[model samples]
Target: MSLRIFEQRYTRMVKEACGSESGFVICMLNSQGNKDLNEHIYPIGTYVNVVDFNLLDDGLLGVTVEGVRCVRITNIKTEADGLRIGDCEMTAPWEFTATKELLYPMDKKLEEIFKRYPEVNSLYETTNFDDPIWVINRWLELLPVDAEKKQEFLQENDCSKIVQYLSGLVE
Candidate 1:
């Protein structure tokens, strides 16, 4: 949920988000290329709320954001300053429910990861070990999967595919 804005061009967008009433920004990973960001971004992205921003030790902008929900982005446009804008329609949050039995080793293993990497732990103020959606989503984020795979999983109407995928990893 935290992001480091290093590029000077992108800092303006963060600052503007801070000043906005909602403090929300839609974020998607940029693919490799010299193409514009609008061309590189995936159709789905997380709309995050800017919780805090500070100057990092390395003189970059360190921003802590909270993921609000998923959105499907469309109708991309570009500004003169090279900023990409798009229409974001709120998409349903992945309706995955997890019981203690389903979460099993994955929940415990995630705690181990947090303990091993405090930097990752510090990104969020709280974590819900009981929330199946949260556990699976966090695991999904940690997986070294391709963007296409991740996007395809998110686009599903239910979590059966993801459940199978995560079960394979957790076991």
Candidate 2:
């Protein structure tokens, strides 16, 4: 459970990635309902591996994906059918280290969230509450902030800023 970016062939892309045991990068749309998808999508994305996939009750595919790392997208091309393809370069995962005491509130709040909403809980096959990086990553995904603001975080080499940012919200 990491980022989920919507696309024209969203389900198809998931299936292709899952069937082939390949990973995919997810980026955000700059604006909604834009016909020019390649131009509209932001450059930063999260590279994730498909953890699980199943045929949903609605007959659509249900997929569980976990973020492996970050990436920067370039040279995007949209096919006639509207599938946007791009060249991606690996970006460093935000780096930070903190003691369990510092991350306790975030970990506990996330635990409460999972307990309160089974649907959200069901998304992850496993959770690492004791790991600060794991907690920080989940907070980034769950935050309701604007995508533009969240995008600013990708540029930060020190993830301690993220830890501070999230602590302010969680506390």
Candidate 3:
């Protein structure tokens, strides 16, 4: 996934992460920053691997990061430079099975849709349509669902449900 950090305050941290062997951490806060720091100090986040980065003329540092896994922050402390550091524990990754019986028709349907809408094909240039997980995840991304609904589906972790949902959407 791509992460765009536009704030000027994070430029140094982003540059340092790009240079380091260990990449960066991405957190999802349950609430806005108005909460007491001690009340919700340690938030869960994703540990990511930086694939590549570029400095843009607009002063925005563009970085491409692939999520490694989910991590829960057990403890957090911020440095003097305003960088937040955390001690985290890796959470169990999502589990799913991609049966060929489930994937065959899905792949065919996706191909048909792509043919009808050639403009969107570029998004899947490096994706493997034959892989059921990839197909489902890509469909989830392309679907016109709201963010909250998409997040719910992602957290569900049931591939069959996702496949069924997409199949219905395709219909």
Candidate 4:
């Protein structure tokens, strides 16, 4: 599976396009060109959507944005890019940790997950990876998806929506 990196603002479009039922939201570092070398650069602090993500495993989202790449991951408590959740209309020099799951994709991991969290469906009912439903479902698990939550996702701007959805899950 090709990793599809996107802005948190585009959650609605990504969800609509991928039809994912759940997953964590990510912000890519816009590292296409060196716009300002003097500025502090961290891999996960980027608010602008542009960065390359390292998808080390197959069937996992390894996509990253193009320019000045950084990720405002929602799982951490750092105040990178204003508040972690809400409309992303501000800028900042901040930091947050990437989720262990985002760093690790599962095939074998699925077996471990099934063994551990039997209550949760880590794998879907269908194995059709290409199907939009299946594809989105995988994304949903990765990004944290739910109906009422996704509706909130559909109504917000990209950046804050990711933070909101992720923050909601942690809460």
After superposing candidate 4 on the true structure, give the runs of residues whose Cα lies further than 4 Å from its correct spot.
Answer: 1-145
lDDT of 4 by residue, 1-171 (tens): 234534443434344334442233344234442424312222233233323345454534454432222233332332432223322323332232333333123333444554587554523333443233222333445654544454444333333444434444443
For candidate 2, write residues 32-103 as lDDT tens digits.
535464657777898888887676666656677877888899898876666777899998776665567888
Of the candidates shown, which would achieve the greatest TM-score relative to the real structure?
Answer: 1
TM-score of each: 0.84, 0.78, 0.64, 0.19
Candidate 2, lDDT over the whole model: 0.78
Q: All models: lDDT?
A: 0.79, 0.78, 0.66, 0.37
Native-to-model Cα distance after best TM-score fit, residue 26 in candidate 2, in Å: 1.6
* lDDT, residue 87, candidate 2: 94
CA RMSD of all predictions: 2.6, 3.5, 4.2, 16.9
Candidate 1: worst 10 consecutive residues by lDDT? 28-37
Question: Where does candidate 2 have its weakest 10-residue lDDT segment?
Answer: 1-10
Candidate 1 residue pairs in backbone clash: none
> Model 3 TM-score?
0.64
Better of 2 and 4 by lDDT: 2
lDDT by residue for model 3 over 41-74, one digit each (tens)?
3355678877877767786677877777667676
Q: List residue ranges in candidate 2 displaced over 4 A.
A: 1-20, 32-37, 98-100
Q: Give lDDT tens digits, candidate 1, residues 1-171.
A: 667998765787887787774654465565762365466778888888788889999999998888888888888788778777788888877676545676778888998998999998886688887787888888988888788889899888767688788889878
